[model samples]
Target: MDTAPKRILLIDMDDILRRTLAEQLSAQDGLRPFPVASGEEALAHLAMHGADAALLDATLAAQGLIPALRAGGLSGPLLLLLPVGMGVPIGGDDHLTKPIRLGTLLTRLKALLNQTDTQSASAGMDDILSLGPYRFLPAAKRLETLDGTRIRLTEKETQILNHLCRRGGTAPREDILDGVWGYGAGINTHTLETHIYRLRRKLAAGQPLVMRIEGGYRLATAPVPA
Candidate 1:
């Protein structure tokens, strides 16, 4: 068993609750909690000293906290504390309903962190990759054709393609939204469909590159033989 202390960052506006959670976490063996009231404070803390995972209030999620943390370079596990009856927010490793029990919180947090550790030990994709007839550059958020043509992609578009390329096969609509837009169940799937439509139009050169399968979508790297 891993004996190292796990540092967890908690972002919530509720001072009493946040402090209570922090204290509870501190009492546990091999657990450390860094509680903050706002996204700015959370980012600052991460910049100075990183945590193993982060938990955010669902209210803060609507204000773009998740994407901000990701843009700030926090690749660690992120969990959302949702209020009762609230729809699931976009972009988190996992979520729990409010009036959260300490036992449940700890259980979910531990699972997400463990998953992160396992994924980290595996191989990751390179910055540059080939997608269909273009050389995909995820970092640059652009694609290049052989003859020197370049296509700029929106951040969402780039994320969509990056995810599809990583899957190496058809990706379910719900999974694509969760992975690409950080949106989970109840969020409109039309957002993903619209992006796919635009991507198909942009990538239409001579053959269809992005194809819609029965369940989801896939990247067709080459045309099928006649």
Candidate 2:
């Protein structure tokens, strides 16, 4: 049986680029690209049907669409496509500067998806991990609120939560980085902190579920019902 292809959201204003990339992605097995011309349309589509990953144009990054997408419930890994000499750093999981080779793009996309796939498989069954008023299913990369709203989690977010859950609701910073990112001790990067901030914004709302400890972070053990 053929499994469904991974869905990739492609947002680019350039018609030629969008069509060309979409065709290239479609030609590859196990991949599907849904192209959109504007951030508004992309946001709408994401709200209704989320994708596995998103490829956004640099113009959208300039317009600060990354935060908007996160606020609008896009929890996938985002990759920004930049034109030559676009030096501004974008808030995304990754970025590629044009002129990009299709093979390079495919390799990057597959790496991102494979990372998530490995973690998801290791997450085991769709068991719910409760944190305060939120319930998270690591395998599904999903979180459910007490009010019944469902929020999807980015792959990294899910991995972080799973790591904390396995460590009795609290874990050291170094341990988290090593477990979730496969980074060696003493590796320095703000990426983990950034993802934590975004996850708190999405999952916590007014009530915080993740708390900072002396040398790490902790998840609330008792369920704080809404």
Candidate 3:
């Protein structure tokens, strides 16, 4: 399994505090922190490289940063650092009083991440992800046709399909490999190709539904809910 560190985006205008928090988070076992001086910087970073969660200074929320991040496609849990005596704000998943207690921050952040993980697992079990004419039940490793015919998928086949579907129906092969098979699984392009071949054979949808693109692969149509 890929045991890479979870990325946390730390947004704060206080250079001293941001740097200190970033340093502290970096020292933790499974966290990698990216500290930004402003909301604009945070958005730019998020557009290019996504974060698993965010830690935002509450003052920035007053400036409309929360909606902007959401509009920019950041779907991570956001933890707000509020000034003492302030009530919970509008857009944060959770909050911590300023003059932050490091222990408390870690605890709350981890809890939020865990909650997100649990929710995602639940969604995978229940949500029928759609791509073209099929409904994909990832947790069950099965696909359903419009007529309710079920096609059993291997675990790896399900992972590959889900990965492609999540990436808007097109993803670089390297990213798909890392996402589905883990970075250090000793799996290679040949392994991926073999899986892709099997998956295509099983999909059985006419019109070349899955195709090899330049430097990547693409689905003929985008993913959608059935």
Candidate 4:
């Protein structure tokens, strides 16, 4: 959304299909698809240039997209599509099938990318992020403290922080509690407060306050400049 059209990473080993799909998405919707022939190519592309959403074929040659996605931060709810039912491991952004309904695929892709963009922008305004001096990098999952110290948080911590930060202001405790910990475990647990306290200690970084609402915690900051 940042004045930039959404980007897509569409992978298809078939040359003709790759070109056709990429062109369709790019030309029709202005979604840039970094089409590649192999899963490795997708990984390489991600290593160098990342995209807002990824469309990985379930049958991509070797190692699949899941492993690479786990390494990189290309994961979101929409990050797991299984088109073709080859039964091979495929993940990161929902998948469809070999003969997918074009409209449905595009709709799902747009919704996912839109959600990611919204969350990212919300996080930007409400939190100082990782680094104290250098600011934060959500995509990279790295944080730097004010005194020039680096703190590399685990995937879990980063995800939890992202959830709170994206909530903007005033996320209810029950909501956060359910989000951070699944409803299954949350039903009989007092761990929510403990985790929040721990997250606060590690991520807050004396930024005045990371949570504004007393009932619960939400990434709270004055406001970003227009």
- TM-score for candidate 4: 0.50
Residue-wise C-alpha lDDT for candidate 4, range 7-82, written one tens digit per residue: 6777767787778777778776557677887777777887788766677666652354565655675554323335
* TM-scores for all predictions: 0.59, 0.58, 0.55, 0.50
Local distance difference test, per candidate?
0.74, 0.77, 0.75, 0.56
Per-residue lDDT over 1-226 for candidate 2, one digit per residue giving the tens place of the 0 to 100 score: 3378988999999899999999999999999999999999998998898888889998887898888887887666777899898854445765678887998788667766765666666644266767766777776677887888888776677788887887778899989877765556797666578878887778555467778889899986742222
Question: Best-fitting candidate, measured by lDDT?
Answer: 2
Total backbone collisions for each predicted model: 2, 0, 0, 15
Per-residue lDDT for 10-83 in model 1, tens only?
99999998999999999998889999999999999988888788889999998888888877767677878998
Q: Rank the candidates by lDDT, best first.
A: 2, 3, 1, 4
Model 1 — TM-score against the truth?
0.59
Top-TM-score candidate index: 1
Residue-level error in angstroms, candidate 3, position 181: 29
Error of 3 at 34 (Å): 0.3
* Candidate 1 runs further than 4 Å off: 1-3, 124-226
Of candidate 2, the 10-residue stretch with the lowest lDDT total is 117-126
Candidate 4 backbone overlaps, count: 15
Error of 1 at 13 (Å): 1.0
Cα RMSD (angstroms) for every candidate in the order listed? 7.1, 5.8, 15.7, 9.3
- Error at 180, model 1, angstroms: 16
Instruction: Answer with 3 or 4, whichever has the higher lDDT.
Output: 3
What would the per-residue lDDT of candidate 3 be over residues 83-115, giving only the tens digit for each residue? 788754455655678899899789778766664
